[model samples]
Target: MAKILVVEDNEDINEILKNLLLGEHQVIQAYSGTEATLLFKQEIFDLVLLDIMLPGKDGGQVLQEIRQSSQVPVLMITAIGDKQSVTQYLLNGANDYITKPFDGDEVKARIQVQLRQTMSQELAGSKRQEYGHIELDSQTFTVSGPLGQVSLRKKEYDIFQLLLDHPKQIFTKEKLYEQIWQDVYLPGDNTLNAHLSNLRKKLKEVDDCHEYIETIWGLGIRLKEWQSS
Candidate 1:
């Protein structure tokens, strides 16, 4: 089941969406854009159903904010089926658009498409794994670290996922290359270091003080054990 955030001010529309999506997914409702934004930061949503016309910070603005940190699928709901609005939302990073006068079947279909795409991506990775304060969704390429949810590139995600999956085992640079790149690890090659640097930087962005990935001199890399203290 997916965790969906439905942002619509119209009480009737919100109810309809909740009713339509309740059975298959966990639905969270936000009557205004501000509420939506707050809930978004406080929760992890699989997909977002956003209405364009809202009280303060419309759907477009919310989409823009979400794009700053997330690539979660956003399906815009609009009564205005104009080319300009559609183009604007798409350019701003909305995954798809849904016109108002909601059709139950169409809503389900569109949601299915988004979720299916997400599932396929996740399947491309291994599975969901967690360690310490970090949780990695291989399917979604999202890592919930100390700071917040950060979306990762494919290679970074695969590397993190591998480490999370085998937290107790240290993976050498060559092994990581063989596992993730499916290629030989050559000496004097900086590919692994570059990716590892980027991955560490991303994690540090979430929590700078704690080292998430530890480089063991001549050994390999492993996640530091979560210290609750």
Candidate 2:
């Protein structure tokens, strides 16, 4: 079962979502955009059900902020006939949209679709590996941390996966370059660092107990040992 974060402000609707999700997965609620962003950084969630008319920061703004730092799937909840709102939110980066006055079954179906897509994409990317205090599920392409598990973008996890796949093996930048991006003919040096930075930051978020990735002076990187240097 996946962990879902419900970001709706309405008490009745929140209760309905709670009941709808209770048996299958863990669900947490955040009533405002501010709360959602804070919880998002503090913990991992599989999907975010965001209401467009939320107080404090609104759905679009919250979605923007999340996309800036995370790739978690977001499904926007809008009002009836709110085509403009849906369009605007999508342009703003929502994974999917469900209108207001929604049927219970429809809500569940849409959520399932997004979750399924998220899972599918993950499975296609990562291969089984253990990095630091984290576990990577290659079949599902998800990463599990101390708090819970969450999905990651391909490039981000691929970099970490490579190091973990061969723990303590020194992989030069060229080797890592060949493995992850498949070629060194494109974005250049800055590109690799950008992805590595993202992986390191996210892994730290998952488990702050240790640093799993270690840079090897002027050569490359290696997955560090769990107990000691």
RMSD for each of the candidates: 11.4, 9.1
lDDT by residue for model 2 over 11-88, one digit each (tens)? 888888889988887999989999998998788789999988888988888998888666788999888485776787
Clashes within 3 Å, all models in order = 1, 0
Off by over 4 Å in 2: 128-229
Best candidate per TM-score, number?
Answer: 2
User: If scored against the real structure, what TM-score would every candidate get?
Assistant: 0.60, 0.61
Q: Tens digits of per-residue lDDT for model 1 on 164-206?
A: 7787888888898889877688998998899899998888876
Residue 5, candidate 2: C-alpha displacement in angstroms: 0.6
TM-score of 2: 0.61
Q: How high is the CA lDDT of each candidate model?
A: 0.87, 0.81
For model 2, name the residue pairs that clash: none
